[model samples]
Target: MAPGPIRVAETPLVSYLLRRADDALVLGHRLSEWAGRAPTMEEDMALANMGLDLLGQARMLYAHAGEVEGRGRDEDAFAYWRDERGYRNLLLVEQPNGDFAVTIVRQFLYAAYAEPYWRAMMASGDATLAAVGAKAEKEMAYHVRHCAEWVVRLGDGTAESRARAAAALTELWPFTGELFEVDGTDRTLIAAGIAVDPQTLREPWQRTVIQVLAEATLEAPPAGFMRRGGRSGRHSEHLGHLLAEMQHLQRSNPGAAW
Candidate 1:
C-alpha cells in the first residue's frame, strides 16, 4: 500500500507566516524613515505610501499567524512584544538604509522576489494566505515598478549617479541569495501546496534582475558567500537597535491604549 501523507506540525506553518510578516513589518519601518528625507517631496510621499502598503500586508499576515498558532497573541503583540531575537525578518530588510541609491537597490531586489513569490502564493490551498498574497501582489507590483524605474534612472544617468547605483547593487547583491533559501517550514508547506518553494523563485528573480540591470546599464555583481540565518531568528546587530526604537512606546506603556 502507498504510504500515508506526511503530517507536518502546525507550528512550522505559523512560523513561516510570521517570518513573512516580519519581513514586511521591518522593511515598512525602514521605508517610512525616508518619508521626510527623500530627495523630493513627491518621492517622499511615494515612499510613505508604499511603506504603509507593506505594513498593512504585515498586519494581515500577523493576524492569520496568530490564529494558526492557536495563540491569544494579536497583531500588536507580535509586532510590539517580540524581541530582536524573536524576529525572523531577512537581514536584507533590516540592513541600514545607506543612501538613496542603496535604498532603491534594496527595494528593487526585494520587489523582484516578492512580486513573483506572491503571485505563486495566490494559488495556495490556504484561503487566508491566498487572499493576503493576492492583495500584497498588487501592491508589490507597484513597488517593483517604482523601484525599477529608479534603478534605471540612476544607473544610466550621470557618471556619478551610475557609479553610486552600481556600488549599491554590488553591496546588496549578497543578501539576495537568502531570499531563496528554503528550510523545513518551507518544505512542509510546499509539499502541501500551501506555499511556494522559494527555490522556484531563484530563476525568475535572476532573470528579472538581470533584465533590469541591463536596461539600467549596470552589470550584475559577482556571487559570493551568502549571508543567512535571519529566518532562523539569528539577525544582524542592526535589528536589535531597530527593535529598541520600534518597541519603545509599547514596552514603556504596556496596555495603555488611547
Candidate 2:
C-alpha cells in the first residue's frame, strides 16, 4: 500500500510557511534594488535574475500559506498588504544593502544558510513544502556559488575591497544568530516533521562560511550577542521603509490589477 500524506495542522503550518515566504520576499526586494547600479552590467543581470528567483519562491510559499490559513489573501496581498510588524522575515534580510561588498556578503551568508536549510527541508512531512524545497535547493545551490565567488573576489581584491568586505561581515554577523534561533513555531513543526529545525543548520553553515572566509583570506568576526525577534514581528526601522516603497503601487490603487 502507498503511504498516506503527512498532515500538518493549519495554525503552526501556516505561520511557518509565512515566515519562509517573507524571508524570500524581503531579500528579493533588497537584491532587486541593485538592478541598474551593480558594479558591472553582467552583475546587474545576475542580481536581477536571483531576485526574480527569490520572488517566485516567495510567491509559491505565500500561496500555499494562504490556502493553509483559509484566508482570502493571495501572494500579492501578503506581499503588499502586511506592515513591517506583521512580517516575520529575518532581520538579516531587511538590513540596508550598504555597498557592493555589503550586498555580496549578505547574499553569501544567506545563501550558505538557505542552501543547507532547503536541502533539509526536502524531507519535510508536508509534501508541498518538500517539493518546494527540492526546487528551491537547485536555485539556492547556484545562489550560494555566485555569492561565494563574489565574496572570494572582493575579499582577495584590492586593499579597499578587502577592508569593505570585512566591515560588512562585522556588521552583518550579529544578525545571523537569529537565523538559527528556534521558537515555538519551529518546535511544533519539528515535532510534526513538517519543518527542518533552523538550529541544525548553524554548525554546518559556520563551517561552510569559515572555509570560504579562509579561501578569501578574510577573518571571521568573533561571535557575540545575536539579535532575535524577527519571527515574533519585531523588525528594525529599515523594514518599514522597504514596505512603504514596495506596497506603494498596490496600496495607492487598492484592488487594481495589471
Candidate 3:
C-alpha cells in the first residue's frame, strides 16, 4: 500500500538541511553550464561528472529534508518549485562562471571547504546524515584534488593564465565567508549533535586554500569584508536568472512527466 503523507511540524533542522541541499543544487547547475564548452573534451566530461556528483548529493539531502518535514514533498518539488528568494544556497555557488579560471577557482574554494565539512558530518548523530556524509566525503575529496590541480596549472602557467587565475581569486574570495557563517539554525542543530559547526571547518579550509594558492604561485587575497545573507533567502541578481532558466521546463509543463 502507498504510505500516507507524514505530517511532522517544521523545525530548524529542515531549514538546515535545505541550506545544504540548495548549495549543491545551485552549484551543480552552475557547473553544468560548462557542458560542451570546456577547453578540452576530457575537461568537459570531468566538469559534467562533478556536476552530477553535486546533484546526487542534493537529491539525498532534499529527500531527507522532505522526510524530516513530513510534507510529502520530494526532491523534485524542492528543486523546481522554489524561487530565487526561497533558496538558501551560499552566494558563492550561485555566482556566474566567468571564465575557465573563474570556474576552476570557484570549484576549488568550495571543494576545499566541502571535503572537511562532509568528513565532520560523518559523525553526525542523525543516521541518514551520517550515511550521506560518508558518500559525499569521498566525492568532495576528488573534487578538491581535480579543481586544485587546475588552479595550480592556471596560476603558474603563462602570463595571461596566471593573471586570469589571480583575478578570479580576487573576485570570488569575498563569498567564501558565508561558507563558515553560523546562525540560530546551526546552533540548534549543533546542540542536537545533528550538524557540524561551520566554525570548526574554517581553519582547515583556510589551510587548504592558502597552501594551494601558494603552490599555484598566486597571492591570497587579504581578508576584509565578506558577503553573507544567502542563508536567509537573500541572493544576488544572478540567482534569479539562474532559477528562471533551470525551472522553466518544470514550470512550463507542470505534472507533464514522461
Top TM-score: which candidate number? 3
Q: Model 3 TM-score? A: 0.96
lDDT of 3 by residue, 8-96 (tens): 34489888888999999999999999999999999999999999999999999999999988878999888888777778999999999
- Candidate 3 — which residues are off by over 4 angstroms? 1-10
lDDT for each of the candidates?
0.89, 0.89, 0.92
Q: By summed lDDT, which 10 consecutive residues of candidate 3 come out lowest?
A: 1-10
Give the Å shift of residue 58 in candidate 1. Answer: 0.2
**Over 4 Å off in model 1, which ranges?**
1-10
lDDT of 1 by residue, 1-258 (tens): 432222223487888888899999999999998979999999999889989998999999989987887756678888887777788889999988899999899998998999999999999999999999999899999999999999999999999999999999888888888999988888998999999999889999899889999999999988788889999879988999988898887777775588
State how far residue 202 of model 3 sits from its true place (Å).
Answer: 0.9
TM-score winner between candidates 1 and 3: 3
Best by lDDT: 3
* Model 2 accuracy (lDDT, Cα): 0.89
